[model samples]
Target chain A: MGLLSLLSGLCRWNNNDEENSAARSFILSSVLWLAFVVSLALILATKFVWPDFLGGTAWLSFGRLRPLHVNGALFGWLSMSSTGIMLYILPRLTGVRLYSERLGNLTCLLWNLLLIGASITLPLGYTQGREYAEFILPLDYLFMSILALLGYNVFKTVARMKDKAMYVSLWYFLGSLVWMPFTYMVGNNFLMDTTGLGGRGPVPGVNDAMLNWWYGHNIIGMWFSTLGLGIFYYFLPVLTKNPLYSHRLSLIGFWTLAFFYVWNGQHHLIYGPGPDWLEDVAITFSVLMLIPVFAVVYNFFKTAQGSWHLMFDNSPEHLPVRFFMIGGLAYFLTCTQGPFQALKAVNSNLHLSYWVVAHAHLAFLATFSFISMASIYYVLPRLLNTSINLRLAHWHFWLLCLGLIIFLGILHTAGIVQGAMWLVKLEEYDFVTGSALFKPAVEFIDIVRLLHPFYFTLWLGAGLMATGVMLFVVNVLLTFYKADSPGGRLRSKGA
Target chain B: MYTALILFILAGSIICLGGIYYKRSIVLGILVPGAMLLIIIAFLSTAVLPYMEKIPATDKGVPYSERALLGRQIYVREGCWYCHTQQVRPIRTDAGLGNVSQPGDYQYDYPHVLGTERTGPDLSHLGGKYEDDWHRNHLMNPRPKTPEEEGMAGKVKGSVMPPFSYLSREETEALVTYLQSLR
Candidate 1:
């Protein structure tokens, strides 16, 4: 980790002087957005039409591209934006300068370079075959170092803050940074035999299953939940024109999420070899999982009630914050439903169905989407040093919600049709074909048929969404200015 | 209708949590819990009220009797809903994977497990499809099995299903029994 940071520091453009910090944020955010556009262009090309990049090569197949698409969304778009948000928020929330612009520069450089390496490696067939953990070993060093830098800088900012009482949002932001890398290390089989690094034939399935769920659930429990809650805690109150409803309930939600959330993870394996006791315990925990989700929602929904006036009047606050508010409610819907699905009786039929995919997308993509957008709306202005285009932001939020719901609906129908047929043994469609390499259009015959209509809807919806993002970045550029930033803008001006 | 229910939930939440935010005083904390309970009840009864029970399980040379019903209990406790489901709504065109979940199929269930996801498939009539070997392989990795053999895999062009190789052979056999008993 240390060695990788040293390397990244070499390439970073240092702009952390009090005068240039926001400029640095704008530049880094642009880098992230560029990568996102490229990645999206690549994925949308395959999703709707094939691009020249995927021309005539087995290694550049959809398999490799899929990883690239997902990584680009998560790390390139989401992560880079997270960096931009943190750069602005830390100083404002704490009333201090960021501890080190150099360290911040190091983190950004490593993150982008890692992506450069991945774009090359994934297509060239140097994958670890793990879901999000697919990057090759040498690249992993940069990832670890970035996380360490993130932790170090966050600690310094918090320690040297003007506000003595830590806000809940700060707790969640710092918690996400501290917890995520630790969770990643364990979930990556970082504990496994590190010697097994390259040219591997299909690794053991059980190990993959464990690692996948560990990462999968954490995407919910840690990544989405913590980030979502951070947005909720900060902006929901702002939208509602109220302070938090109950600080006590806020802590209750946090501890409950931390403890019970881990227990409920195995519910993802209800149909597999996850231990029966663990599964049962998870079901118990899953049912209880609703407690925190609703607690979080109630905390916010109640807070936002009086501010309903603000929602219509303040599109900036309303659009981004509403997604999260609605997302919190959806979280309640999904989690409660999740427990019922965990019950063995339900598992007998629903396992591996599209319904599960729908539920997951709802939580990760849709619900967390609200929170992620809220972060953008709240922080992008500060990063770009001007007001964002409210109309574009509103359009982005609605399209995002609509796209996710409809896309998920199509996928849900496809998965259910597949699951239902196998359960009933329908003679008309139940013919089995023998082949190792799949003859496409068979297992997903229904979905393939459904794709004609569904894909158009999904494609159009996502297209509109990407357009909205473009408009936003344009607005960021349109709004760009050098604000006479206050005293808390950088670290040297602080305690 | 969904709007009404949501509006009610939102309103109830406000009345309950109103004092806490405005006055910085905790009052009407009962609202969130009450709203949640009402929603949970509505959801549960929806599952329970619509169940049917006509499934048959064969044991050895003879048809499985009511005792085979115990397998379903094991199924519920195992958290199979996390991966599989037992219901088949109409808009789906995948493969009709559930054993054609019938209204009469869940008569004996205390809580009908008509799950909501298709990470796996519905098991409404999964009474007797595979030999133990086929199931062992399918459970091990759905990818290895031919679509002609099982699932939408052979039928669908591209799919991914991780093998459940972690179940001990004994646990696998018990689960198999439960699956076979689903018909």
Candidate 2:
């Protein structure tokens, strides 16, 4: 029985139900990557407090590890898990199996290989030097091709749907599929250094800066957020066991988000060299982004009206719903902060500070990552026909929540201090000018010193988050392997 | 410039509205095309339009030398730009950094490395800030050499910069050259 179960788990493609096969493979792959990358992040957090922790190792240095951490978290953990959710959700919504389970498995295999390649290459100092779009050219091409395959698999399934009426989640999933490939191409392979695409060179000068941010922000807006929203929309009614609050509101949120998000990327350059008019345009759209944010939050709360007790409940059945509730709250805070920080006055102070880092974590970690966790919990048990340990689930949830709060709080406080220190002017003697100069009241190095304690605390928070994620991973593995054991098996009604 | 931008936005909005109105299917017909149009409008305005704008002639802007170009590649490979920013803004935090960065100054910077974060100080005007030896030594050991030194005097205090002593001498020289060429 052990050997048979192991084989069944490993060779999911051989399973008769193709959608379940593909989804289980993708989820399994995603959890392993999450474990690996979260460890990498903890290492990095420790290095911030103790720079010489892994001294003299080139691959282990902060620079190489930073990109690895970012790419691993973004592509490895988040994107793969999203693909799993999409694959799982699409068949049920459309009332048709995936077009090719074999193709889906192939994409999953290739995606893992791509991340493995990144781990090796990035550590070896091979990179394009772009943030969020940092994979080397060949890897970039591989990623695009893999994305295309995933799109083809899902789109063909959508085309063959028996149900003519599409759910709001289907709209979001399909839209993200269409947007992701183009966004990846423009951001990673094409715009900068057209040599890869058979063109002259990069977009001239600061224009490349504008293009980079446009790609960076849109990847989050178009791909990550869209995918997460699709999962959020689908699971909200499922876990809550309630009809959607308003279909019209979901549509409004979708369209408005698609409209305003692409325009708000340049707000990253608020007080920089980009033209003042461009900044103004970004700021305007950024504030307008509130419409979609409010729409999504309102829909979530209204639909979750009577089910709020489930979020507070400690039952294993309520774990998935709990994840969504916290994710919704984080989503509200993150979106509010997004428009607020995009303003010229706020950005000037917080632009490059750890405040921006905190904002990013709030959006990506607290919001989207939480949503992905919710979807996984909702889908995985049903797929495996097993139950997660309630005690373990509760520990996982609270640890992650507490860890992120502490981590973000320290980063925000340190960021404000860093920003203020940089702005504090003090009159000082200048040897070069032979006169008094208006020097910063706190030297840059002094500020770095002041943040050391915060970095250490941040590491502690990261450690807790990592511990929680590991527990989640362990719980998942237990479900797969020890299904007959106590607190392990669940006879879910449907797949 | 503003006129061109305003006209472009108006035209794009009209086309999007018309397309959505005509083709009302929620999936492929409206959502996909609507998204495509919005991204196109954004790409044209933010990236392509800026590329078409003329760079004003200035003595401050100079193309990278052959060795300097090689150094730039080395710098990129090592991911130095992850911590250090190359662009200086007109904002108060950037007061003592350097001259406010202009578009013209980066005319030859292909795939411009106007980095987002500043774990280290801005390197926009670092060309003549220190000697070649100083940079080499600094890269070898970014922390203070002697216990006596503090702040930005002979050594930077409280620096979390990782030592690059593992880099080959040639790569180190190239990276130093790239840092010096930032001016």
Candidate 3:
């Protein structure tokens, strides 16, 4: 009953003209939760180097803790934060108030409930045994409902738009909303038994893999990537005081991305048992993705042509712009690396190595997380009606950047070395003779040992990144409370 | 190939032009139907059609028993797939990992566990590679045994795998059963 009253109180806002209190609260909570989970995940990652750091606990074992970390970061952190940002942006873009802030607040509450449930359930060993789609059936249903609620709210707002022309960001936002629920259903095989559909039994093994990757890649591509790009489109112009360069280019990028990314999932199974043609199709589409990537890259860079100087202004107001610029550059690099790695030769060496891990981080952390941070910075001041601490924000940005570079640099090197050694070892063994190709100069254990120093480097980088996240959280909290104080109330930019 | 490409182009065209050309029905007519069709086609080609072609006449190998299935659950619970890949590719680097994985080999997998990493070696053909006793010893402590121990010589000396000694005996046994059933 107390919980119910608290939730009702949260939804009851006094001033509801333009400021989205519910959305702002959701974004703040999501960012804080993200920081917490990311720190825990990184600490758990250190167990790789120091196995016995906290090894004895059953629930705290690397296996259970790792999934919690992955799911927590993906769903709890990135997805929730993205949804909160979308809520804030949608009303402003449409030039209308949100359809229902009360509904939005309720959704936020339920979303947090689901996240908490997942954090508890996953550690307790209840899972469906799928990466990214690991949440059991019940939780999956809850997520679908959340998506439906969000989609309803956003579409309702769009329906009441004061502006007739659909902006590029709105298009991407709409596409993501359409894409995510279906992708989740297909990837998780949720519709199979319920509809009594044809091919209703469990998805065949190889085919399940294909379906999983399709869902996995599209989640990143359609949901996070598109949403991040949409946020970028909205914020870039606002920050730069410049119009978007080539609106046509933005449309082309969106279309190409939607068409191509779904097919790229099979690239993950390149040398696995999938049909040759399927692999070829995946590779072809992955390479074709270069079109959209280059278009988006050109659009962003050209838009920032004159406004690049703002990034160097060293003002708190410009810090978010700096993040957007750096994230845009990282997005460009990540896409380039993605297509290159999708090639069979490169994949053979890098597929299962730490190279893929590095790529995932570059996409998830460097590109999307950075963009989300910028969005928060851009929107937070407007929502709170006050500025953040410039000094602390600067510290957050540099520390994160430095940490990512070190982490990626070390992992990529380790992956290449491991891949090369594996190849050499394989070549030495004669398949027909079933004997040593040559007396192996080093064993696989030697390769494992070789990676220890790199793992230590990763730990150090993660520590630095965690510190940066804490600083960001603290700065945001202090600014928030300071603005809420009685003395600061006089300066409040209230609706 | 042509069909897939045409479908791809059609999907892209609908997504791009749907909102701009016909704003009235964009959400219900174009966006919903177009996205749904794309998903259907993707599933048809990649999953359903592939299954029709690849379904085995009879089960391959022994089906995972209840115990092994429970062990598989433990594997998933622990996130073992994060480091250890279950699929062996047909490349030189995968030569020592045993036979290249086949679709039929994973016939019983509900949510397929053909993992993507090899932080440890491929486990697709791990069955019978070593004794159950060896697995128990290795799981408890990955350090190589002394030369005085039987069959200890020439084994890989150092390993980065964390001990699962904390796992209850039943859990460990079940996990071992699942590992042995992989081949």
Which number leads on lDDT? 2
Clashes of 1: 79
Complex DockQ, candidate 3? 0.45
**Per-model DockQ:** 0.04, 0.52, 0.45
Predicted candidate 3 versus true structure: per-residue lDDT over B101-126, tens digit per residue: 77777666656778888788778878
True contacts kept of each: 0.04, 0.53, 0.51
lDDT of 2 at A406: 91
TM-score of each: 0.64, 0.92, 0.90
Candidate 2, which CAPRI tier? medium
User: Between the candidate structures 2 and 3, which one is better when assessed by DockQ?
Assistant: 2
Measured by DockQ, the strongest candidate is 2
Candidate 3, residues A277-341, lDDT tens digits: the string is 77887898899999989989999888888998998879777878888888898899999999999
* Candidate 1 lDDT, A334-447, residue by residue in tens: 766677777876665565665676676676556665455566666656543456677766775666566566677776675566555545433343346632221123444343
Clash list (residue pairs), candidate 3: A63-B78, A428-A437
Q: Alpha carbon lDDT of residue A446, candidate 2?
A: 79
Candidate 2: C-alpha RMSD to true structure equals 3.7
The ten-residue window of minimal lDDT in model 3 chain A covers A192-201
- Residue A73 lDDT (model 1): 60
